[model samples]
Target: MSIVWYYDFISPFAWLQWPKIKALAAEHPITLRPILLAGILDLCGQKGPAEIPAKREFTYRYTLWRARQAGVTLNFPPSHPFNPLAALRLCIAAGSSGAATEAIFDWIWGHGRAGDSIEALAPVAAALGIDDPVAAIADPAVKAQLRENFDAAVAEGVFGVPTLSIDGRLFWGDDAHEFALACLRDPSLWNEPEMQRVAALPIGAARQA
Candidate 1:
């Protein structure tokens, strides 16, 4: 099974760990899957980062330290937590076309003021080495597929941004990311009894023949 890198470009924390994540993906047999985030939040009745009152302060402070630690250059700019629902759909729109979606993912989380404006995405897109993902975003089939991804993420028990799932076990949080990296580096570490039992399950009766 592959690891799913579930993220929304609008999340700063998601942007922060991106460098390491991409590097980790390179070193392991991981398929970086980008899922649209806003749909997940809406389905859950969760507000944007800038909207939540109780946890917002602590979250930003934590994110600042995290960005510094990861060496990601971030400019939050003057913007409310801009919605990336459309962008998320756009990402789904660009599926399997190559690095366009991945590049778009990086730009959304990595650069200046993610979620503020579509224009902000241009520079990040350039950095990812793809300037035109607009074509994918504009397609009707792709748009619907993206919406479906958000629905899928919610159905899968995802509650946070930058969530990762490996072999169907969920890892949610930057702290969990390292664990994901470790499991990917050494599949032998996955000898837990539960997983072994599941893996060993017979698909069909041997006596059927």
Candidate 2:
């Protein structure tokens, strides 16, 4: 079982979920896979939440409240959804270089932005020591690698941010992280017939929904 994090650099909800997901992953011995949120958007032909009228405003405040509860600090990404191509390249570069890609993902989600200039990304790149990510990202080889990452994510039927994949099943949202942790650490959580339907509901949804 693996946590396939499908999040864009610009998404507030994904940003809000970052710390808890990492904490959960560390507490459990689960593998974390960071997939491009842009690819998910492409597959769905959708944009960021801020593009919607009510949802944009509503989710912005809602995200802040959740962030407060989650103990995460986030700056709203710039107006336009930042490009994930470079970010994805950087991720692949870090992974290929034998560094902890999930750590880099944590940084980006916790604070970094695709809208940041290369100069802004310099410190993180240096810290991760991925000095050549820009070059690597521009190279045909690494670009192909990034493409493969996106393609693989799509092939797995991922269509949303923070989607966790256990075996072949998918669970989405920060609200679903507990089930993800449960399913990952113990398959018994999903071994029952009724478990199938129960896992489909959101966290606390059995009570609320």
Candidate 3:
């Protein structure tokens, strides 16, 4: 089976990790799965880093720092926390190819452009040889595929974008890319006693809702 990468256009971390993931794809099969970050956050009853004022500033700074460290060009769109639904659907409509995925990422994070609406994403569609992104994203099939991807992500216990799933193991965040590769290189790592112990650790405290 191919390694599954769950991502959202709203995530700069995803954009940061894309290059490494694409490099990995040169040697291994990787599947691009576009998901709604908001849906996952809602399902888990948590706010995104951007949703929290202090965290938002830090997230932006930290991500930029990371990009610089990785020698990757980084730029935030004019507005953030913008709706990614249209862009997500466009990916699905475009058959989720690596080229299309890279193009979309470049359009958003690389160029610092807003992709919240079909009209805004017209250039991306045109680049992908899609005549009408508006119609493409409006298709019922495209909408359903995006929902299916979200549901699959939830089922996989995915909590965030830039998550890599390999052999039923999830490595979350751009920082976890090396961890994912390590696990892939040594699947037995998960079989360690400490790994099992941590996996079964019981919650000792709870916050009342």
> Which candidate has the top score in lDDT?
3
- Tens-place lDDT per residue, model 3, 1-209, is 55999999999999999999999998899989999999999999999999999999999999999999999999999899899998999999999889889999999999999899988999999999999788899999999998898888988899988899996689999999998888888998978999999999999999999
Best by TM-score: 3
Distance from true location, Cα of 17 in model 3, Å: 0.5
Residue-wise lDDT of candidate 2 within 119-148, one digit each (tens)? Answer: 556566777776765675577876777667
The ten-residue window of minimal lDDT in model 3 covers: 160-169
Better of 2 and 3 by TM-score: 3
Per-model TM-score, in order, reads: 0.71, 0.74, 0.98
| Whole-structure CA lDDT of model 3 | 0.92
Alpha-carbon deviation at 60 in model 3, angstroms: 0.2
- Model 3 TM-score is 0.98
Q: Give the C-alpha miss distance for residue 21 in model 3, angstroms.
A: 0.7
User: What lDDT would each prediction earn against the true structure?
Assistant: 0.64, 0.63, 0.92
- For model 1, the superposed segments whose C-alpha errors exceed 4 Å read 45-49, 96-98, 105-109, 117-136, 185-209
lDDT, residue 40, candidate 3: 96
Regions more than 4 Å wrong, model 2: 1-3, 27-29, 45-47, 96-117, 185-209
Query: What global local distance difference test value does model 2 have?
Result: 0.63
